[model samples]
Target: MGEHVRAGNLDIWTEQVGRGPEVLLVGGLGDTVESWQFQLDGLADRYRLIAFDNRGAGRTPMPDGPVSVEVMADDAAALLGVLGLAPVHVAGFSGGSIISQELALRHPGLVRSLVLQSTWPVMDPYLRSWARFVRRLVEFAPSERAFLEDFFLDIYTARAHNDGTVDQFIEEVLAFPHKQAPRDTQRFLDAFIDHDTTDRLPGITAPTLVLAGGLDPTARPELCRSVADRIPGARFEILEGEAHQPFQEIPETWNSRVDAFWRELAPVT
Candidate 1:
């Protein structure tokens, strides 16, 4: 079962399962614990997996005013500390990847290893253009559902659309129990625009695995490679046919890749 815990000044909603080495899953913009549901059975068998809703997402109450990547990272660290699950293997997706980078840079001792998927370290022109387009969609869309439908088009691949996966995902979103406040959604969108951790990559000391989808349009594979190059000893790989959210599109491969990385770091018992 999931429960609310006091993390810093916010009541953060979190869920955990399985046992063994801890793995913390941080999700992207508007992603809740449900976003990581596909990994539960695969990863939970060998690790205690924890997933939480970031501030401005899902059940977590958003902080007032503007937010930053550092602020979100602090929230993740605070949540783990309060639950006595620090120094965990941190896996992040998209916006969560940005926060994960900040978490490692600011609280190195709290992160045992890092898995960054569909990530980029800098908000270059291509990304900034998308950010602006997202802002406009959020601001002008007639309704929440309308905004989501339009937004998903840019994130998923053509194959997902052809196979009805996009439709299924939209249904999932529409049926999700907790809805994020529009204002909170905007806060997260704005924070993503300002997030840039390129200069800070060298500070991370964790064993890092950077995964990118060859078909992912948002965080292109080459940009992800740039991130890998900046971090000392970090390895980068591209899932040829996968898109931005590979875990959802190709769970088996995503699970195996992530599990392999963690297993390598596990001590022989």
Candidate 2:
């Protein structure tokens, strides 16, 4: 079921499925709860999976002024607190992974375990350029089709693009009712660029899993490795041939890896 939780001034839209230990799923900058459709059922059977749209996306409208990764993390923590779901497992991707880092840092008691996928602890020249270029493209693109065409290349692998999966993705994106505004996207992109948790990884108490795609251009292998290296005992896994959207590209592998991590820590009693 889906409902709105008042996270301070924002009315964050949240969804829950199944019934067990809670697993919170945080998505990318402009992603909504639907972004985790592939993992919802797969993880829900074993964990009460909770997914929500961040502030300024989907049902949550952007508030005035600038926002930061810390704000977004606080929003997630607030939602969990309101729903009585502290110390839950958290899995986040791309921008969401950045927020997850902040969540683990600021609300350590609320996270039971962590999964950071296709994310970086610090934004460097390469990632900064990509974020800037994407913002410019979204602002000046003549049409949504042109934007999606350009975007599909960056997020999907060459094989997936050639195999028609990219086409389906474009269609799904076009079908969404609440498309992210270009300005809002730029704001979130800025948050992603400004976020740096490299110095704080050691403070995390949760068991951590960092998953990266060998072929991903966005969150490159070295970037993910650095994030994992900072967290004590954090395990890093590489999914060869997959790109930025590994969960979507290889659902079984993504879901199974996360499930195994969670199971080992707190098996069903």
lDDT of 2 by residue, 1-269 (tens): 68888878889988889888999999997899998999887777778899999988888888997699999999999998888888999999999999999999999999999999998988889988998999999999899989989977889899888999999988988988988888898899988886788899988889999999999998998999999999999999999999998999889999988888988998954
Using lDDT as the measure, the top candidate is 2
Per-residue alpha-carbon lDDT of model 1 for 1-269, expressed as tens digits? 88899988999999999888999999998899999999877778778999999987888888776598889999999988998977899999999999999999999999999999989988788988997888788879998789988898878888998899998888999898798877777778788886778888988999999999998888899889989999999999999988899999888889988888888998513
In order, candidate lDDTs are 0.89, 0.90
- Measured over all alpha carbons after superposition, the RMSD of each candidate to the real structure, in angstroms, is 1.2, 1.0
Q: Report the poorest 10 consecutive residues by lDDT, candidate 1.
A: 260-269
What's each prediction's clash count?
0, 1
